[model samples]
Target chain A: MTPPTDPFTAFAPALAGPPRLEPTDVSYVLEDTSLGRMLLAVRDDGRVLTTAFAPDAAHEQHWLERVAQRVSPRVLRHPRPTDAVRRALEDFLAGRARQVAVEPDLALLSDFQRLVLTGLAASVGYGRRTTYAALAQHLGRPRAARAVGTALAGNPLCVTLPCHRVLPAAGGVGGYAGGPAAKEALLALEARSAG
Target chain B: MSLPPFQQLVDDHWRDVARLAHGLAGPVHGDDVAQQAWTQALAAYPRLTHARNLRSWLLTITHRCAMDHHRTRGRTTAHEDPASLAQAPVEPPPQAPDDVLWQRVRALPERQRQAVVLRFVGDLDHRAVAAALATSPGMSRRLVSDALATLRLELTDPEDPR
Candidate 1:
């Protein structure tokens, strides 16, 4: 074989010589729900990272940057969703736990956001609903409805925070960070749970 | 709010990390060393306080992993010889240009070879190379220059100056 012109280019084969890192710290599991395909990432200790609506793998790839920024960059995929996480997600999605509140790990959240999240977690139940204005007022920041929206949008733990239960004050269901479709599904699911 | 580019970390650094491992432990244990380094690094990636160069951080991990492998082997499963690495199962064949080049890299003197590999293969800067090799930046630069000069004579790159 002729010696390569450039050493760096020539030595590229060694790139394949070593085993790669496969992180198992965080695991991803995809489930097809009534709304669409939902991709959920979880931690070893059963912390629900995010439940995004991913109609397909391409759709899921859109969240790579956000997922890394919000949850972790080293997340790994489990062969299947863990039983505990699956059960919790099923209960939440099915609206069986609507009257109850949820508390997911909020390590990535800010103090002010945590305060707002804690308030929402305490006040809103699965079957109940609140408006962003009401939530801001509840936190004594009546003029901060937009800020409340920003906080909810950045909520590290989505469904667990029940951000879906919050809506626009004027009457229509509000925007959900997961997607508008997911919000509609959750609201519809809750309406049934309420009855 | 500005976090490091986490998603691209492995995809960008894996090859460089592997090259460092192979350089340190030779072909046989190279894969193992790289694996351990990634596992360890990925486990601690979340709380990473800061790093000027992510590659250096990865090399630091790879270097430690190689050391651990050597420590565990104690003298039994010693690192492979450069001449013998041609028989490594991972690559195409010894006749392949890339394989030939790597074998030559393995033949370089210890410190010079490490400096060269860390500089080019691991894509580390002078300071990072020095940090990984536990030497001064000046020493790392000198070693790389000397090694590259030798490689130039042997491999004969027209683009590179002697």
Candidate 2:
């Protein structure tokens, strides 16, 4: 009797019958943007042999191995974004104007800052605009728009909460975490969809 | 205290996750339940430091998600025929060798069957089972015991205690 040819034949073992695992030919790219480092791993067939994370080779290699063990070493075709960012991107692409879940990885913020970010996350909707002052008012401190802007300027997950959707009441594109070009692109994308 | 490595935790406790899923939702939907549970757990990983028991915490989340899925499905399935419920054949009871005993076990109320499966299949202690079912431990224990007694009576032969 011949065995299955693929090595990833044990991917999902808990299912009723034996599930055949097909080796996916894909490349996974991990970006540690805050640290200005990126790791790219190309899995030929099912085996991951070539892995690289620039700027800090040793630390990147260690982090790659650690992350690999928790998730499948075989990366999905595209770069993985934070869950919140991914959800926001999907909603934007699908022509929906809402985000269901916020990304949990908003590092470098105080607890109060996070609460403000959460309010901002909930405030911005698809195809609509809210001012920073409007957001501060919603948080029960109308005087805190500048503080709210500071919190949003440091937002780690860019598109998920549609932070780019916030603008000045005088009708200016407010500061964007991803910079003005990215914000312009996002707004244009949303505008094209709405049109 | 520094926590154990995430991979090590997942490797050590993945079986418990599967069993909990199976108990909450039978085999057909268990894998989806487990997958969604893992996703939710990973999303909640940043707050894991506050959790006392990782295993129980994971199980609680999985159980809640499974129950939510079941309720959503029940609402969606309300209009379906009750007779179609028997689409899936029941696996023969492991200890109940007699057909009569199997029939009696099948006839037990859904809550009693769920409590029994949580006890046996999930290997969850009585208290954990009660927590999973959102009921009192005494009630959970009574449900299982009463279920077993009913099976025993239906399957008993007058000739032997064995």
Clashes of each: 2, 0
For candidate 1, the per-residue lDDT at A150 reads: 91
What would the DockQ be for model 2?
A: 0.02
Per-residue lDDT tens digits of candidate 1, residues B1-162? 434434467666778887778767766667778888887887788778765567789898898788778678662222244444456666633344565566666677868977887787677889988998899999999999998777667776567634
DockQ for every prediction shown: 0.31, 0.02
User: Residue by residue across A88-192, what tens digits does model 1's lDDT show?
Assistant: 767766666653232366666788888888899888876788999999999999999999989888765667677888888898877765578778887888788
Show the lowest summed lDDT stretch of 10 residues, model 2 chain B. Answer: B91-100
Docking category of candidate 1: acceptable
Q: What is the Å distance of residue B83 in model 1 from its true position?
A: 13
TM-score for candidate 1, residues paired by index: 0.71
Error of 2 at B16 (Å): 2.5
DockQ, candidate 1, comes to: 0.31
